[model samples]
Target: MKTVLKALVLLVVVVAVLAVLVFTWIGSRGISARDDPSGLETVVARTMRRLAIPRGDRNRQNPVPATEEVLAAGRAHYADHCAACHANDGSGETQIGLGLYPKPPDMRLSATQSLTDGELFYLIENGVRLTGMPGWSTGTPEGEEASWHLVHFIRHLPEITQAELELMQEMNPRPPAEIRQQIEAERFLQGGDPPPSAPHAH
Candidate 1:
């Protein structure tokens, strides 16, 4: 029994030492968002995230019922705010999503869909630290309701239709320049007016 205890203690000490060394080395080198985490790093980060959420929070139920109205509100909110990072179908393939370190997961997949509704709601409200996700909850009833609606929308991700995606694209934000150009083009096509030429660079 003593030998077993000693071996366990030694193993724990060795792991702790190695962890500190690795942390120091990484800090010295400077971590970059542009760099993808290693497989081991990814596993560790995910495990840490899972462990950080309280069991009570994870088990909490979504108070909002799944209804068409609720779902529609969620869809609109996601399209306007989240579509930049998480695509309409939750594929997370957009430029911003791809650029993020530890790039956003494909939410339509089991890894995301399998999470409890409460877990999703808490994440939406609390946001993950050191990641791009921002907590949407503004400490208001409206904000909390929005997050709950989003949880419903996330659950519907697997069943999102192509038509719905097309509709969402219309809601997604466009760059100011793109919006201006599109408006001018539409005017011209309607025989209203041709847009003035852009200023030439020196």
Candidate 2:
């Protein structure tokens, strides 16, 4: 009986070690594949295609067309945080983005076809871990407030012409403050209070 128990314990230990090894290998395998762009793109495409982690969409609708002020704020965030990885024009960057095993999605080309405002909201808010996206805590604790504004900007992105995109970029857009960021807790606190755009004033 003792011999059987010992065998079982040994098997459990081996299985645990193998699990860790597999994840570590996945992490490293991606880095090495960067040398070959095609292979890297293939892998990245596969991973992002994985069912996005389920999250509640903020119902963050685009009520009013983004004003220059609002769009500017979004642009600033994109330039500071996202542009490095996703690129200013939404074409995506080379070394950091393209080099990744799963290449970033082409937001500019596919926004209309591939994603919805709800799916985009959920994905941005929760973010995919171990992936390039870091969930914006704007509406959540520990995230920047301008996250929604960033979302506003993202919604408008598909319509931008190549030249217009540049002009808007150069317009010195504002950045959403770290404090003004709305989170779920605050909304709960307000209870009956209406959201920023109420009754479709547009």
Candidate 3:
């Protein structure tokens, strides 16, 4: 009993010292979204994320089957919703993606591809904390199924063809400015004056 108590006390002291050193390092480096996470930080964060997931969730199997229909649905959904950050090719090369600290992973890479289907689905539904990812759960069966479809699509990213990529580009959401330009161009073609531009912020 005395030995156990001593071991516990030593563990607490070691943890406290590590905490102090981490804080001191942070204080010296300062925090910035522009800075990439250190290797230690990346390992710690990934470990925490893995540990945070419930064992049942981590081991859960995908209920949806991988089929062309499901993959198409996932492709369209990803292009319209996730492409803004994840990119159509899952390259994570969009302007917003590049600016994010610890920017989104290239889904084709092993780091992302190696994750189990369950892990991918959980991350999509629940999202990672302290990152740009947002929980996409709609709390409905349909929503859950959509996320499952996405897991299959993520797995397919490595072999995505140019034809599929072209289809995704068509599905991607257009910026408001581009939409407005299209409207104005249509008006001009129909022999109408373009609408006046909204006042710009000073």
Candidate 4:
């Protein structure tokens, strides 16, 4: 018991020193959204996040059953709220997703897919700190159920259908400029006058 405690304490100290050094290096260089995390950074962050979840929470089973109805609700919810950052297929390919510092993860990959359902649920309910992901839980029963539903949908990301993608594109939020461009394109297709050009900046 004494040796185990000593080893744990030594590990903590070593990790703290390494963390300080890494942060100092980052501070000197300045972090950019375009910069990918170093292998060391990735490993450390992944380890810390896994350790953040309580053992009990990690072991808890998902209450929601996998059903088409549940999956449909999850799909719609993900399209409406998550697609901007995570993308409809969980590929994290959208502009916002790319721009985030750490970038949203590709959920279709084993890195995400391998996580236990409870871990995923915990992450959805209580988001990781220092990342773009925000806790989605509303502390309500419906919110909890929705999160559980999303877990099932995440598992299905690898097999997402083209029809589902098309539906999600319609559901995705559109910037006003993009919407206007679409409107102009539609007008031109209908044989209306070409959209007016913007004045050139001096």
lDDT of each: 0.88, 0.63, 0.90, 0.90
The whole-model C-alpha lDDT of candidate 4 against the native structure comes to 0.90
Error of 2 at 96 (Å): 2.0
Instruction: List model 2 lDDT by residue over 9-46, tens digit each.
Output: 99999999999999897787655735544667555754
| Model 4 vs truth, CA RMSD | 8.6
Q: How close is candidate 4 to the true structure, as a TM-score?
A: 0.75
TM per candidate comes to 0.78, 0.53, 0.78, 0.75
Clashes of each: 0, 9, 0, 0
Clashing pairs for predicted structure model 4, backbone only = none
lDDT of 4 by residue, 1-202 (tens): 9999999999999999999999998798787886778789888999999999999989878899999899999999999889989989899998899999788989999999889999999999999899999999899999999999999999999999999999888878889999988877876776665437743222
Cα error, candidate 2, residue 149 (Å): 2.9
Candidate 3 per-residue lDDT, tens place, 95-159, comes to 88988877888999998888888899999999998899999999999999999999999999999
Stretches > 4 Å off in candidate 1? 1-32, 194-202
lDDT of 2 at 143: 51
Instruction: Sort all candidates by lDDT, best to worst.
Output: 3, 4, 1, 2
| RMSD to truth, every model | 7.3, 14.3, 6.4, 8.6
